[model samples]
Target: MKIAVMGAGAVGCYYGAMLARAGHSVTLVGRPQLVTAVQAHRLILEAAGRTEAVPVDATTDPSGVAGADAVLFCVKANDTLTAGRVIASHLGSSVPVLSLQNGVDSAEHLQAVLGRPVVPAAVYVAVDMPAPAHVRHHGRGELVIGPGPSSADIAEVFSRAGIPTEVSENVKGVLWAKLIVNCAYNALSAVAQLPYGQMMKTDSVPETMRDIVAECLAVAERSNVMVPGEVMSTVLGLAASMPDQLSSTAQDLAQGKESEIDHLNGYIVRAAARLGIAAPVNRALLVMVRLVEAKAQSARR
Candidate 1:
């Protein structure tokens, strides 16, 4: 399959490298720095104490997506509309685009912009870019892609590439489940600059997470999305499962990059407002993250 990965951040590079290694022709469209690094040394993928350079095409131009059979839209949630606009003219109407992003609304948002079908995918992986063109995988690399005309075939390709993929009719629910987890921890982790283990250990952290999850669950119920799993259990288990791992938002904040708070807790806040529901806990977290981001910006000046 001819694959194009838009964004080429840690998530993009990790999955793109996997597909490339599985012999799919993959082109990564990203920033010049990453494009240059990938062009020079392929993509360095580090996983399970092993590192391998996976060769794939890399470009800084959105036009790189033109001939792709499928495109993976992996940009941060806040970049969805901007990146969608950049690639809209270049993408074929028939090409299947998958939003392999954190937020639940990205695929729908991108689809609205592109006027084309887009599959929502729940990306289950812990990855980070330690350097340009390099992706370090902590663990778990799988995806649950929403049902679409091309979902089965895409899932097959990804599974063949050792990505552990599944095509799901309930991907939205899965996404909401994941979103709830993010709402519970991402802001707290970012505000504290702590990994999940330490963040969970802090006083009142568990209680706060529970409150966030409760608000998200209420919002999800009103939205008619059945968020799977016991929310509190999942929220608490993440810390044990990825003890030393920082929330992606925390990592982004630490790098002075914009965190996706607007999509996580902020999404819940908006949804609650629309449904005439109260989400004070979620709103508080969203506001706190925004304040932190604002403070970070001021520090830069």
Candidate 2:
């Protein structure tokens, strides 16, 4: 399969590398820095106690997505529309765009701009880009993608590339389940500069996470959203599952880049408000993350 990874950050790069290693023709559309690094050393992937360099095409131009069989839209939640526009005219009309992003709305949001089918994928990967062109995968590279005409084909391609992919009719619920997990951990992890295992060990952190999960469930219920699974249990199990994993928001903050707090916990806050309810706990965490983001920005100056 020929694949193009748009917004080739950690999530994008990680999957791009895996597919490339599986002998797929993969191109990464990303920043100049990553292009430079890839030009020199190929795409560096560090995972499972080993590091390997995979030769893959990469360009700073969004037009790199032009000839792809599938495009993985993996930009941050807030940058969806902007990135979508950059690549809209370049993509083939029949090309499948799988949004492997942070928020629930990015796929549909991108589809509106491109006027093409966009597959919403619930990404279950713990990964980060520590350096230009270097992807350090923590654990779990699975996807629960929404139902569409091309979903089965997409899943087969991904699973063949070593990424477990499931086509789910309840993909929104999967996304919300993922969102609830993000709300419980992303802010706290970002604010504290601690990974999940370490953060869980801190006093009052588990209790605080429980509070966030409860509020998120309330928002989903009020919005008539069905969030499947034991979300609270999923929240509690993260410490053991991905112990060294830091939230993507944490990675952004650590690098002095803007974090996506507004889309995670802040999404819950707005949803609650729209339903004439309150999500004080989620709101508080949102505020705290914003404060830290502000601090990170100020210090960067």
Candidate 3:
């Protein structure tokens, strides 16, 4: 398979490396630093006290996606439209595009921008870029892609690369489930600069998480998304499962980079307004995170 990964950050590099290791022709389109590092030393994937240098094609230009049979749109939520437009111009209209992003609406947004079908994927992985072209995997690496004509073949390709992949008919529900989890923790963790375990230890934190989860659930129901499984347990279990792990939003804030609060809690707030429901807790968290982001930007100046 010829695969191209756009915005080759943490998640993109991890999966791209795996596929490259599996003998696929994988191209990673990313920043100059990453492209230079990859061309010099290949992609360094570190996990479980082991490391491997996975060789793959890498470039800083979106044109690198030209010959790809499939594209993994792995950019952050805010970059979806811009990256989609860039890649759309270079890639063939028939190429399958999978959106492996944080938010529930990324695929739809990409589709609107590209005027093509985009498969939504629920990514169950914890990864980070410690340095240019170096990807660290913290936990699970599985994907649930939305049903489509090419979904089964895409899932097979991923499975061969050691990533557990499934073609799911209920991808919308899967996305909503992940969204609820993000709504519960991303902003709180970012604001407090704490890991899930430490933040949940504080009194009233669990109750506050419950409030946020309830609001997200109401919004999901209003949107007709099922949100399968017990969402509250899933939200709480993340703290225990990855006690030392920091939310991606927290890492973004600490690095003075933009956080994805707008797509997480802000999404809920907007959905609530459309449904005539109040989401005060989610709204407050979103506003607080935005204020922190603004302050961080000002401090950098």
Candidate 4:
């Protein structure tokens, strides 16, 4: 399959590297710096105490997605529509476009913009881009994608490429579950400037996470989204799952770049308000991350 990875950020780079290493014709469309670095030394995957170079084509043009058999849309949630617009004309009419992004509505947003089917995947991966061409993997890299005309085939393709992929009928619930998990951990890690394992060891962090998840579950209940599984257990288990990985928000703040905090906790806050439910914990986390972002922005200026 000719796969196109649209963002080339941490998640995009990790999956793209895996797919390319599996012998597929993979192309990464990213920033000029990434394209230049890849052209010079190739894409690097650092994981599990080892590293290897992945073979893939790289380009800065959105048109690089042209003629791709499948597309992985991996931009931040905030850039969903903008990136969708940029690549809409280039994607084939029937190609499967997977939104491997945070938040619940990216696929819906992209589908509207592209006027095509966009698969929504609940991506669980701990990875970060240490350099323009280097992606460091910390832990789990599984995808739970919602049903689509081509979801099964795509899932099989990913599985063959060493990516654990599952096709689920209750994708809405899956996305909501992921949103709640982010609500529990992301802001805390960002505020503490710590990885999951270290942050979880701090004082009263488990309690704080419980409070946050309680509020999130209330919101999910009010929204009538059947978020499956034992959420509390899942939240508690994350630190162990990706001990060395920092939250994406933390990475964004460290880089002095904007994050998808608004889409994560902020989305829950909005849902709570709309449903006449209280979400103070979620609201507080959202406010705190926004302040951090504001401070980071001011520092840059």
Candidate 5:
């Protein structure tokens, strides 16, 4: 299989390396820094206390996807449509593109831009890039993608590459569940500049999270998405399971990068409004994160 990873961030590098290690020809397209490092050495993947220099091709041009059999679209939510357009002319007309990103609408949005069907994938992993072309995996790495004509084959290939994968008929609900988790934690963590453990210890944090979860559930209900199981318990248990982990939003802020708050809590707020339901808690969190982002951007300026 020839795989093209559209983003060379942590998620892309980690999965691309796994496929390369499985003997698939993989190419990563991204920024110049990642391209330079990857072209010089292999993709340095650090996981489970071992480092593997996985061989793969790298390029800064989107045209690197020209002959790919499949593409892993891993850009940030805001870049979905733009990235889709950038790669559309380079991709095969019938190639399967998998969106392994956060937020519920990325796949749909990208599909619209490229005028093709895109598989939506819910990614469960803790990954980071300590340096360009170097990916570090901290914990679980599994994927649940929507059931489609090509889903089974994709899942099989991913599984063979040492990635746990499932083809789920309820991918919408799964994505909504992950979105709910992001909504409940990301903004608060970023605003406080705290990890899961310390963030939960702050005053009124639990109550705030409860309010956010309630609003998100209400929004999900309005969207007719059945988020199965004990959602509240799962949201509450995240801190205990990953005490020191910082939300991606927090990490983004710390790095002076644009956070994905608009796609997380802000999406909930807008969706709820469209359905005539108010998500005040989520709206507040969205604003708070935006304020922090503004401050960060201003400092950079």
Candidate 6:
């Protein structure tokens, strides 16, 4: 099967490389820097302390999505609408698009813009790009995608590429569960520039995280999404599971790029407001990250 990866950052490159390695034709659409790197040396995938350059088609143009049987829409949450329009302009109405992003609402947002079906995918992975077109896998890489017309076929293809994938009818809950975890840690880590272990050492930090989690859960309940797992336990266990790892928001701020706080905590605040529910803790965290992101953007200017 031919696959197209939009916004070919770490997540896109990692999965695209896997599919390419499995003998599927893969094309990565992204910025000029990543396109140049991939064109010159393929995609460098580093996992389990081993590195291999996996060859695949690379382009800076959105039109690279053409002829793809499926698309992994991995753009940042803020870019969903714009990227969706771009894809819709280039592709036919039949190709399946999957939002393999950080937020709960991207698939809905993209579907609205494209006027086409989109599958929401809950991704459990900790991978980062150490350099352009290079993916460094840090932890789990499993996906639970929402049911759609082509979801089963896509899941089968992804599984064949060594990516553990399943189609879940309850993917919204899974997405919320992941979002809650992000809400609990992402902004705090970004603001302090600390890893999970060190962040937990700060006075009252764990309690504050619990408060944030509770707010997010309340917001989730208002939205009627059954957040899976023991939410508090999962939030607290993150430090032990990935002690040295910084949140993606932290990494984005460190790199002078905009973080996805608006989609994490900010999304909670919006949902709470819409549902006539209050989420003060989530609101505060959202504001804090927004301030930091604004400061970073100003520094760049």
Error of 2 at 209 (Å): 1.1
Clashing pairs in 1: none
Better of 4 and 5 by lDDT: 4
Please report, as a residue range, the 10-residue window in candidate 6 with the lowest summed lDDT.
84-93
After the best TM-score superposition of candidate 5, give how far the Cα of residue 108 lies from its true spot, in angstroms: 0.9
Model 5 worst lDDT window (10 residues): 241-250
Superposed Cα deviation of residue 197, candidate 6 (Å): 2.8
Could you report the Cα RMSD, in angstroms, for every candidate shown? 1.2, 1.0, 1.1, 0.8, 1.3, 1.4
What are the lDDT figures for the candidates, one per model?
0.90, 0.91, 0.92, 0.92, 0.90, 0.90
- Highest TM-score scorer: 4
* Order of models, best TM-score first: 4, 2, 3, 1, 5, 6
lDDT digits (tens) for residues 241-295 of candidate 5: 7787788898898888998888999999999989999888898888888888888
TM-score, candidate 4, is 0.98
- Total colliding residue pairs, candidate 4: 0
Clashing pairs in 2: none
Candidate 2, residue 289: CA error in Å?
Answer: 1.2
For every model shown, the clashing-pair count is: 0, 0, 0, 0, 0, 0
Q: TM per model? A: 0.97, 0.98, 0.97, 0.98, 0.96, 0.96
Tens-digit lDDT track of model 1 for 77-138: 99999999999999887899999998888999999999988999998788888899999998
Q: After superposition, how far is residue 212 of candidate 4 from its true place, in Å?
A: 0.8
Task: List where candidate 3 sits over 4 angstroms from the true fold.
Answer: none
Candidate 6 versus truth, CA RMSD in Å, comes to 1.4
lDDT of 6 by residue, 1-301 (tens): 9999999888898899889999999999999999899888989999888999998999988999998999999999989988888778888669989999999889999989999889999988778898999899887788999998899999998998889999988999999999999999889998999988899999999899889888888887877788888999999998887777789899999998888888999888898898888889988888888888788788778
CA displacement after TM-score superposition, residue 139 of candidate 1 (Å)? 1.3
Better of 2 and 5 by lDDT: 2
Model 4 residue 189 CA deviation in Å: 0.4
